[model samples]
Target: MSWNPAQYLRFADARLRPALDLLARIGGDTQPRRIVDLGCGTGNVTRLLLERWPAAAIVGVDSDAAMLACAGSTPSAIGWQLADIASWRAGFSPDLLFSNAALHWLPDHDRLLPELVGQLSPDGILAVQMPANFAEPAHRILRQLAGESPWRDALGAVRMGSILPPADYEQLLRPLCHRLDLWETTYWQVLSGADPIIEWMKGTTLVPFLQRLDDSAAGHFLAAYRERLAAVHPAGPDGTTLFPFKRLFFVARR
Candidate 1:
């Protein structure tokens, strides 16, 4: 019930690809002495990062204890640290700072970002992947649908955080890290069954939404979201659903 990633593993392949792609951008023989995985959730991507940089001293940091615990149990040498990235300050010079499907949760990174970048060595690499589907129908429509639902009475001013665009990121990050590569990709996923769009959001955006609600209210929120999705996303004649999802990715070398 507390932000379980295992609940959404049905669409795991599509949801996890961006993280793998971000990790793949690291060049050969560029391994540093220490690495940090910011927003390392459930250790899925963290495991891959360790595989890529096996000998590097890896640190996995996240605010969620449950997620940190999960990461700790994963087969890796990653030192799981439960810390809120916004205020946690450390002096360790990292060789690489990697994150996937996480930075969008921290919009205050305008300040926290440069600070994290400062912890990296001059030759350190930074790779990040984020879900840019916030402004699109997937998120906007959910906000709109929530307003008309029964849970609207209990739901206060629950607004999704604003995620900056690629240009905005490039402007803030390009100067800090050299040879920056940033771009957004829309993945047209062919899923099966109805309400699969909501299923995809379950693994990502729904975390914040669910965290704020009681059990009964959360059920109502999911029910209403499914109703709206069912009406909007029609089932295909081929008996499979089509959900075009979007994600943003960035990689840079300091």
Candidate 2:
């Protein structure tokens, strides 16, 4: 699916907090010579990687050409590559493999996660963060709406891949790494504007479903989705909506 960099960066601060949190926990003593930011959209988090490790050679890999263009447009030493994160391989072993809010879209993490860990250089670190809020109303409603008439044929098969549970991830990665850290955090994001949740999903969760429909059908689907979301997440007297988003983070050292 095509990505809108502007839409995705609309909630930049909120989207970035987890990434910053993950970066802080990545062992301050680390002095990696090479780093890879997998699924680095628009190089937002990739920039952070550079800031933390100025001497490290950093490459940001993403499948979307548009996003890579936006990232590259910004003058920096960081190299931007257009490649699928799921099948991406480093020409040389990277000291750090960092991915923020990516990798959930790929299937078969059982094999994928271990392979990623193996790709890291000896004593390398693999730090990742992924959204684990699939059961939330935002996604549940999207799935529910897509199954109804007019949209079923177009979207019935549309699937939003999700991450494994905390226990499952521990079981999958502990054996591959000498050190592993896994945790979850629920960010009760305070958002403003009418139908903020819908706006939020438009950047990520809504992209696939919206892409499957024509403009007219997509409009209707969005309208229905907006109505349902408002009922569940009404704006408070302060005119801000609270969206509790849960995310999973892991830091593994090989």
Candidate 3:
């Protein structure tokens, strides 16, 4: 699916919070020499990696050329490469492999997690964060709408759900690392604007459905989706909507 960098960055501060949280937990005695930002969308979080490890050779790997173009060049030494994270391999084992809100797009974590861990150096750290809010109304409504008439035929067999439970990720990565830190955070984000939830999903979850439909059909889908969301998440007295977003995070030190 194509990505809109502007749409994705609409809530940049909120999105960057979890990346910062993941980075902070990767504390160790030694600083990394080489770092890889897997699926680094627009290099926002990749820039944070640069800040943390100024001397490290940082490479931001993403499949989308649009996002890569938005990432552009950084003042610090950083390489932006267009590559799919599922099959991406660093020329040398990286000291830190960081992925934020990207792994959910790929499937088969049982095999994928181990492969990623194997690419790390002896004392390397793999830090990742993924949205665990699939069960929330924001996501469930998307699946509900997709299963309806017209849309069902248009978006045939498109899998919208991909994230695994926290326990599942722990079981997948525990044996591969010497030390592991796993946790979940639910951010009750107060968003302001008209249909903020819909706007939020447009950048991420809604991309697939919207991409499959034509302009007219996409508008219809959004209209229905907006009605459903507005009912569930009505604006408060202050005219702001509260969106409780949950995310799963892990840090594995090999």
Top model number, TM-score: 2
Model 1 misses residue 118 by how many Å?
1.0
Candidate 3, residues 1-254, lDDT tens digits: the string is 89999999999999899998898888746699999999998998999888877889999999999999999844557899999998988979999999999999899988888999999999898999999999988888889889998799987677765788888888888889989999999999999988888888888988888899889999998999999988888999999999999999999988
lDDT by residue (1-254, candidate 2, tens digit) is 89999999999999999999999999878999999999999998999999999999999999999898889888998999989877888989999999999899888899898889889999999999999999999889889988888789999999786988999999999899999999999999999987799899998988898898889988899999988888888899999999999999999999
What does the lDDT read for residue 184 in candidate 3? 94
Q: Which candidate's lDDT is highest? A: 2
lDDT of 1 by residue, 226-247 (tens): 8667666677889777777778
How are the candidates ranked when ordered by TM-score, highest leading? 2, 3, 1
Candidate 3, superposed: residue stretches over 4 Å from native: 73-75
Error of 1 at 109 (Å): 2.7
Displacement of the residue 213 alpha carbon in candidate 2, Å: 1.2
Model 2 misplaced regions, further than 4 Å:
none
lDDT of 1 at 82: 81
Cα error, candidate 1, residue 150 (Å): 4.4
Model 2 TM-score, 2 decimals:
0.98
